[model samples]
Target: MKVKGVRLYGKDDIRLEEFELPEIKDDEILVKVMSDSICMSTWKMVKQGANHKRVPADVADHPVIIGHEFAGDIVKVGKKWQDQFKPGQKFAQQPAIPGQAESPGYSYTQCGGAATYCIFPNDIIEAGCLWTYEGDSYFESSVAEPMCCVICGYKTNYHTKDRYEHVMGTKKGGSIAILGGCGPMGLGAVSYALATDNKPAKVVVTDVDDAKLARANEVISVEEAKEKGVELIYINTADMKDPAEELKALSVDGKGFDDVFVYVPIKSVAELGNQILGYDGCMNLFAGPTDPNFSAEINLYDCHYNSTRILGSTGGSIDDMKEAINRAAKKEIKPSVMITHVGGINSIVDTTMNLPDIPGGKKLTYLQFDMPMTAIADLRNLADEDPFFNELADICDRHNGLWSAEAEQALFAHYGVK
Candidate 1:
């Protein structure tokens, strides 16, 4: 079958092209990609290209597809797995396959969600990372992998009292803080921390932009947090002379936050997060820095006496992905809160190149490459010029300017999908 996708040739060289998809092997499965959410990691891969550690060595000779976080429908199943999986079933995958040096989106030449169709390798299929999803929208499932990473972060976080057995996942009924909490990944951490069963008594989210902070509050409201028995606070550090001190003051007894998530991969923010860790507090460096030798200072005295520890995690396991999928199905964590922009596959190159500059949450791309990347808030402006956009604006209004299953259906309907 002929398919269209964005292929990465080299650093700063990504192109949208049409090509023939070779026949899938007997052990492979064919999938029709429905929705793919642009991740910051994907942007990093775009910048690194051939030099990326996970990218295949032969990518320069044969270009590789560029997206990882995606959801789709099964078009064909291999004979061996015909009973296990069938055509017309919706699914999502945990792209980080264990024991495989190359991941699906970064290393696979013929497999990625950027294309209309892709083949699931035998390794991925056999590993059981491919998940059948029954969520309301494929967009929600597309972003589930990142949410899984967030869940994995919490699960992996632990406090070593005498040995490495004391597991404290965000310290239930304790105060927590998410530094740089306005970005999409930060917002995912916020929602997961607030909504999960192991709830925090207080959550202080900090960011420089008041607009982004306001959007965060709108999406995950203070009232919602209150309903979950959490005191949610959004703070703009730009307005403060001593942001670290201000954050520490919000903690109970003024000791410090029980859990501090350093979402920004900068030295200053990391130092600030270190400064505000309570006794036995765990600080998670959630963002991956571009620089290989990126270093941050930590108070060793506090680490020894205060018992504060620091950790970092990149992605999640297949188990974490299943947990995210189940949670999304139960409406426990709304992954769609991370989505702010919607586009088609054609916009992949432009969106990936300028992701950092684009001021919104996740940028979702549909396999049907027709619409340009459009912000939900901008739909109102577009409504005046076109009736199709007017209807989209209404849908946006209905969903509080956020993407939803209904909004996705409305969009496909507007595009005349049968």
Candidate 2:
């Protein structure tokens, strides 16, 4: 079958091309990708190309697909899985596989989320990476992968009560802080923090940018969190007299936070998280660093005496993805808040390449359509030019100017309901 997608040939060398796929083997499946949310990891991969560990050294000769956080419909199921799988069912995939650095959207040329169609190899099926999604919104399914990472970050964190007795997960009903929060993943972090079973008593989110903090709060409002018995706080440290001292003051009993998460890969943010830890505080470094030698200062004194510690993670596991998909389906966490821009397959290269400069959260793409990357916030401005935008703006307005299932349906409707 013929497929069209953006392939990475070298550093910053990506092209939209048409290629043919051989017939699927037994035990394999073919799917039609509908929605793919561009990730910062993709931007870093494009910049590093062959130098990336997951990318092949011969990437210039054999190109790979460009997206991993995506969702779609199954078009064909092999005979080996005919009874277990079928066409027209929605699906999501977890990219991490045991002992395989090369994963979907990083190493596989024919198995990627950036195309209208791609094959799900037998190995991926056997590994239990492919999940049948029962959700109505494909964008929500595409977003579940990142939300899974958010869930993993929370589950990876640990706290303790006594010597040699380590407790897993964040401290329940304790004070929490997210340093340099309010970015894309930071927003996801907040959503999970509020929605998790063991919700925090106090949640403080800090960012240098007031705009980001404002938007984050607007999407997941303080009042909304208050209804759940959590005192949500948003602070712009740029406006503080002494950021660290002032931030720590917001913790329980004006002591320190029980848990802290560093969302920005900056030395200051990491140090700030270190300074805000109360006794037995667990700081989770959620952001991935591009630099190989990136380092941050930590208080070893606090680690020795107060049990303050640090941990880092790259992505979520299969179980995390299942929980993420379930949470999104149950409306416990709105991954839609992470999305700010929408585009099509033709827009993936430019959008992924220039993502850091773009002022938004997740940039979602539709593979079957050809449209420029447009901000969800800017749809009302385009209402005069296209009736489609007018309908989208109205639909979004009804949902508080955020992306919704109705908005996704409206977009597909304007583009012939792809």
Candidate 3:
């Protein structure tokens, strides 16, 4: 079968082309990609291209599809796993295949969700990274991979005084701060921290843009945070005289925050997150920087006397993905909260290239190839120009500008595709 997808050849060299997919072997599976959420990591891979470690050296010769956060349906299964998986079943994946440096979407030449179809290699299948999904929408399932990474970051920052055993996760009933919390990944961390059983007394989310902060509040409302017994505060520190000092004052005793999550990989942001940690506070660098020698200053005196520690994580384990899936199923964590834009496969290239400039939570792409990347909020304005968008705007308005499974169904119906 021939499929259309955007492939990366080298740095700044991504092309959309149609190619023939080879037949699946006895140990492989063919999936029809339903939804793929563009991730910042994917954007970084696009920018780095051959220079990226996970990118295959021969990518310039044989281009590779670039995406990872995706959900789909099993169109065909290999003979070896015919009994385990069947056609028409919904599926998602962890994407961080255990031993492989480059998982599907980053390294695999024939596998990625930017296309109508992709193949699951035997290694991925055997590692059990692929999951059978049961969610409200493919968008939710696709974004579970990123949610898993968020969960992993929290889990990684676990520490203990005794050193014999350690508590894994943020301190309960403690003050927490999320730097650059308006972005999609930061928003996930904010929602997770607020909603989870590991309750924080207060969560102060900081960003430069007031619009993004307002969107964050809209997506994860104050009422929702109050219901969870969390005091959620959104702050724009762009013009603050001393943002770190102001953030520290939000804590109960004004000592500092218990857990600080740095969502942007910039040195200044990371240092600011470190500066606001209280005694025994743990700071998790949640974002991956493109620079190999990304360095930041640390207060060693605080680390020694206050027991402050810093950590960083790239992706999550398969188990973490399962946990995210379970939480999404139970409504403990809403993956849909991260989706702000929707479109089809044709939107992948432009969306991926200009992801940083695109002001939205997550850009979700369907394999249908007809729809352009359209923000749910923008549909209202589009309604004035086109009757098709008018119906979409109505659907989005009903959901308060948030993308839902119903809206997606309406879109597919509008496009006359499934």
**Winner by TM-score:** 2
Residue pairs with colliding backbones in model 1 are none
Error of 1 at 75 (Å): 0.4
lDDT of 3 by residue, 1-418 (tens): 9998878899988887899899999999999888889988888888888888889988999899888888889999999999899998999898888887868888988898788899999999899988687776777888888899988887787757575367888888999899998888888988788766788899999999988988888888878898989999999989789988988998867999888999988899999999999988999998888777999999999999988899888788898888888887787887777888888888888999999999878898888656778887887666666688887778777776777778878877777766
Q: Which lDDT values do the candidates have, in the order given?
A: 0.86, 0.88, 0.85
lDDT, ranked from best to worst: 2, 1, 3
**How high is each candidate's TM-score?**
0.97, 0.98, 0.95
Candidate 1 vs candidate 3: the TM-score winner is 1
lDDT at 318, model 1: 91
Alpha-carbon shift of residue 329 in model 2 (angstroms): 0.7
lDDT of 1 by residue, 208-253 (tens): 8988888998999999989978899999998998887888999976
Residue pairs with backbone overlap in model 3: none
By lDDT, the better pick of 1 and 2 is 2
Candidate 3 lDDT: 0.85
Better of 1 and 2 by TM-score: 2
